[model samples]
Target: MKLAYWMYAGPAHIGTLRIASSFKNVHAIMHAPLGDDYFNVMRSMLSRERNFTPVTTSVVDRNVLARGSQEKVVDNITRKDAEEHPDLIVLTPTCTSSILQEDLHNFVERAQLEAKSDVMLADVNHYRFNELQAADRTLHQIVQYYIEKARKKGELPEGKTEKPSVNIIGTSTLGFHNQHDCTELKRLMADLGIEVNTIIPEGASVSELKKMPRAWFNLVPYRELGLMAAVYLQEQFGTPYIDITPMGVVETARCIRKIQQVINEQGADVDYEDFINEQTLHVSQAAWFSRSIDCQNLTGKKAVVFGDNTHAAAVTKILAREMGIHVVWAGTYCKYDADWFREQVSEYCDEVLITDDHGEIGDAIARVEPSAIFGTQMERHVGKRLDIPCGVIASPIHVQNFPIGYKPFLGYEGTNQITDLIYNSFTLGMEDHLLEIFGGHDTKEVITKGISADSDLNWTKDGQAELNKIPGFVRGKVKRNTEKFARDRGFKEINAEVLYAAKEAVGA
Candidate 1:
């Protein structure tokens, strides 16, 4: 295995934990080392959860390994069932414990024989799947298990809701803006005279999974996590699902139309044209702002987009189609959804990258030098080093991305928030030109101090003087480019000649 300082997605067990912790009175028991228990701390810190993270680790120390792991696993499972009284206990294995090749399913069976609560093994191969895949599969597994159990007990419903209703799937704890997005979705549904039956896996009980068929249809907002469950529901119960993520004004209108069409197909009478028009006219300012002079300034401005599949594809379409920004390239780390992501963004981006390697993503950004970046936290670091303004659109994010304000990345309000993000993320060409000509006070300081202190190469006085002529906002990029150019050519120092040569080579 390779060492990764940062990863686009965590191991498979973390995904299982995310799903288990998302629900009420559902606990997860991970059979692994103590270090693997960090998920609880991360969830508590990032999500600011009021309650304790509903997960436990069956610590696999050297002593346990010398003996066997099954006893410890069974003990933890039974203890959690008794002490926590959870509705369901998800038993999973981490990358470390999977090497032991112990029978985790057998352990679950043993625990279930003694425990009051239901226990199931999250049967995902950590070697084959990553975080997003594991989360999606785990959710599907839980839904299937609960639904089948209810069917066996004759508790499953056989009818849809009397009114138009939908089940919002794939929202869970620690998701990117899930709380705000769910709120906006509810508001949108309420305004359109639609009823929300249930939002799955987030503040939901395991018992509610069997009642999911009550909704007229399902709204799977995220492609990464809920599409599998929706597909399963459609195949089994004939419940149609709308998987369109309404991130921009144009897509939001389309999503509304899709919802109306689905509800009408289910023999319900609902017209959403007035609701759409009203929302576009008053509730959402994105459509209006896109036509304004300020947005016009960004008509042809270039940007690079990279993140998870859902947000990356949605934001790319928004930038290219709605905001009139030129998306130089787009990509995602969700390789499982790469084909779908590429198809979604084909018209917008000429180039599409599908890899989890942050180094490759950083190289691409450096090569393209797009004015703005809409990506995850990794791209945020790349943007800082390259002096490109960036707005985070996906996970692998920092705490600041989870703002206190109502910043939803879905529905009508999301369009407004995204428009603001795009507008503020671009360093306007005109402003840079003016700053260059006016010679800002910070330019000299930046040129002298340089962008990165880790650089070993020295810069000549002549090179520093020449860099000061460039705009202060872009001086860091220029310096980095020059240093890279010099380093490539085996130059010990960056001088005036080296700077000019680097500029010409980069077509700056």
Candidate 2:
């Protein structure tokens, strides 16, 4: 395996932990090294979860490796079951533990005999799968395990609720705007005279999951996490599932109509056209904003989108079809879903890239030179380096992405949030001219700090003067690019000719 300074997704065990922690009364016991327990810290910090993360790490140090890990694993499992008394306990292994090839399934069997709680070993190959894939598989495994148990006991709910209801699947802990999206989805469903039957994994119990098939239909918004379970439910229970992620006006309307059609097919009445019209005309301002004069600046502006499958495709379609922005390229790091993502976005993007490597994504951004970038936190850093504006649209994000305010990215309200993000992400025409001519306060500070920094590569008076002539907003990027160029070419000092040559060579 190749080494990378940054990764788009974590190892397989993180996905398992995300699924386990998303549900109430569900605990995860990971047989891993000490350093591998950072998922708890990351979830606590990023998600701002007040309660303790429901995961226990069975530390597998050198001593444990020397002595077989089965005892420690069983001990931790039984202890968590006794103390937490969780309804379900998921046993997993980290990449390091997976290398040892221990009999984790046997450990689970041993623990199950002693523990009162239901113990299930997560079937995931750490070497073969990443976080998203592992999470999807783990969630499906958990659902199947519980649903089959319910079936054996003859406890599975048989009929749908009196009112049209849907189970919102695939929302879990640490997901990008999942809580807000669920809230928006509930609002949309209520507006359409539908009730939410159950929301899986996030705040739902194992018992609730058993009753998931009772809903008239299922809504799987995220492509990465919930589609597997939805597909299984459809195959087993003959329940239809809608996997549409309603991010833009057109898609939201389509999702509403799809939901309406499914409900009406199930013998429920729904006036979808009127509801759609009311939402478009009153509830959502995105349609109005797109047609307004304020959006003229973005009509033909170029943009690049790179994120997870759902957000990447959704944002690309919104920028291309709704706002009339030109999406130069659209891509996702979810290589497993690359074909589907490409098909979803082929009409909107000029090119589609599917790789987790930040280097390739950065290179694509530099080559295209899009005015705005809608990507992850990694792309935010890339944008800062290239002096391009970036709006983070997906996960692998910082704490700032999880805001306390009601910023949903799912229904009619989400359209407003997305449009605002797009409008603010681009450098408007008049604002750019003004900033270039009379530098803003932050721009002046950045330029001064960049020029005054003490670096090994010396800049001659002529080179410094030439660099100062660049626009303040992009002055730091130019300086950094020129310095990199000079350093690569073995130049001790940068003069006016060197600056010009570096500018041309690096396209700063």
Q: Estimate each model's TM-score.
A: 0.93, 0.91
Roughly what TM-score does model 1 have, to 2 decimal places?
Answer: 0.93
Scored against the true structure, residue 190 in model 2 reaches a CA lDDT of: 86
Lowest summed lDDT across 10 adjacent residues in model 2 is found at: 444-453
How would you encode candidate 2's per-residue C-alpha lDDT over 1-508 as one tens digit per residue?
5333788888899899999999988898888898888887788889987785458889989899788998988999999988989998999999888989988889999999999999999999899899999999999999999999999999988887888889999988889999899999888888888889999889999988888888999999999999999999999998999999998999999998899889899998777898789889998999999999989867998899999999999999999999999999998989987899989999998988999988789878876767889999999888766668899999886898899999999999999999999998895323644766765534433332222234678889888888877765466556777777888989999899998998788664
lDDT of 1 at 31: 89
Query: Residues 1-508, candidate 1, lDDT per residue (tens digit)?
Result: 4334779888888898999889889988888888788987788678866785457888999989899988888999888888988888999999888999998889989999999999999989999999889999999999999999999999999899899999999998878898899999999899888898889899999988999989999999998889889999999999999999988988899999999999899898888898889999999999999999999988998899999999999999999998899998999999877789989998998799999988788878877778899999988887777777799999975777667889999999999899889898885434655755776434455522222245778879997788877775677678877888898999999889999999999897
How accurate locally, in lDDT, is each candidate? 0.87, 0.87
lDDT of 1: 0.87
TM-score of 2: 0.91
Give the C-alpha lDDT of model 2: 0.87
